[model samples]
Target: MKTKLSLFFIAIISYSCSVNQNKTKQSDLPIIGTWELISATTKEKDSTFSTFNPKLKMIKIINPTHFSFFQHDLTMGKGPNPTFAAGAGKYTLVNDTYTEYLEYFIHREWENNKFEFKISIQNDTLTQQGVEKVEKLGVDRIITERYKRVKN
Candidate 1:
């Protein structure tokens, strides 16, 4: 009986450690690089997807526990003075959910908002999708962005 109880305890401890290791390993696998935004799409209420051809180019960089994303329009003063449209903050990735806490943004109202996205990676492509409700934009929709991993 003593030997059986010891074996059971060892199995339990080992299983618990493996679970934690998996979480850590999985989080360390993807999203640790600079990604350039390839495309952005929004899904309407009727289940139709509309692509937003952004005037600015967007780039995102993710570290272990922090991330920064920024966009700059290269157009030389065509509309609204093509300039900076960027934000950055800390991020947490658990399982496949990516949550970003806005620490800095051009619009003050956007700061401190917790933005969550469902993330996936394949080969050199990264995809993120999430439903966003922006009262200022007067629209609530699902946004999906595809990014290509930038070669360092």
Candidate 2:
């Protein structure tokens, strides 16, 4: 009887530990899902705000350790000024601060750059804003982007 009791207790402890471990891993990821970009704005060095393209559509997919984004014109690439952009990289999120290490991009000059942004989540919306300064690329601006979570 004692041996059976011991085995049962051991099984209970093992199950409890596994459940707690799963919860901890899930809690660590607050931004694991698909998000669609709704709007964006860029503030140049002169403190002028430039609205992003209203007709363009973009989506950013984030997993446990990596993120990727794809953007293009809504005209199915048939517009007079067709556009498409995509990039993917690993990222880290510590509380409200998120940092992305750009690993792959069509624009080679923008690769291997670290971009950090402050992020916030409200309801189903996520907003991130930070400075984007790459001297070699001649890009210096503060960009703010708002995204809505894409529900599956």
Candidate 3:
């Protein structure tokens, strides 16, 4: 009888521990949905910043282990060439950090690129700030974006 009780308590403890670990992993980023870009800012060479035109529409979709985003100058409908830029790949979320490996991209230059960002979501909005070095024209550029969750 004592041995059975001991086994029962051990099983309960193990189950409890597994449940807590799963919760921790899930809480890393509760970011699994489509989001519309509110703004995208880039730090310029001279330490200045430039934001994309508000008229440009960008959308991001996150799934269990894959993600994709696309930008369009036209806000609606399919065009002969609507995508300004688009990419899709597998992604991993750890703690507050999100990383994506570019498996496919409209622009060939970005193919196989890796993107690391500090991700945070609050009040129906999501923010992603670049945590990796991105250079252009011999100047370091940083990307910051704010997105609003699209409710279906």
Judging by TM-score against the true structure, name the best candidate. 2
Put down candidate 3 lDDT per residue, 85-124, tens digits, no spaces.
7889998888888888989888666667677888899989
User: How well does each candidate superpose onto the true structure, as a TM-score?
Assistant: 0.73, 0.79, 0.72
Off by over 4 Å in 1: 1-28, 47-51, 76-80, 135-139
How much is the lDDT of residue 86 in candidate 3? 86
| Candidate 2 lDDT, 17-125, residue by residue in tens | 9989776232243688899988888989667665667798889999988999999999999989999999999988877888899999989899999999999898899
Write down the worst ten-residue block by lDDT for model 1: 21-30
Among the numbered candidates, top lDDT falls to 2
Kindly report which residue pairs in candidate 2 clash with one another. Answer: none
- Model 1 C-alpha lDDT per residue in residues 1-152, reported as the tens digit of each score: 99999999999999999988777434544789999999888888778565745677889999887889888876855777767777889988888888889899898777877778999999999999997766776667889999999996
Candidate 1 differs from the real structure by a C-alpha RMSD in angstroms, to one decimal, of: 5.3
The runs of at least 3 residues in candidate 2 whose Cα sits more than 4 Å from the true structure, single-residue gaps closed, are: 1-29
> In order, what is each prediction's RMSD in angstroms?
5.3, 5.1, 4.6
lDDT of each: 0.83, 0.88, 0.80
| Candidate 3 lDDT trough over 10 residues, lowest sum | 131-140
What's model 1's lDDT at 116? Answer: 88
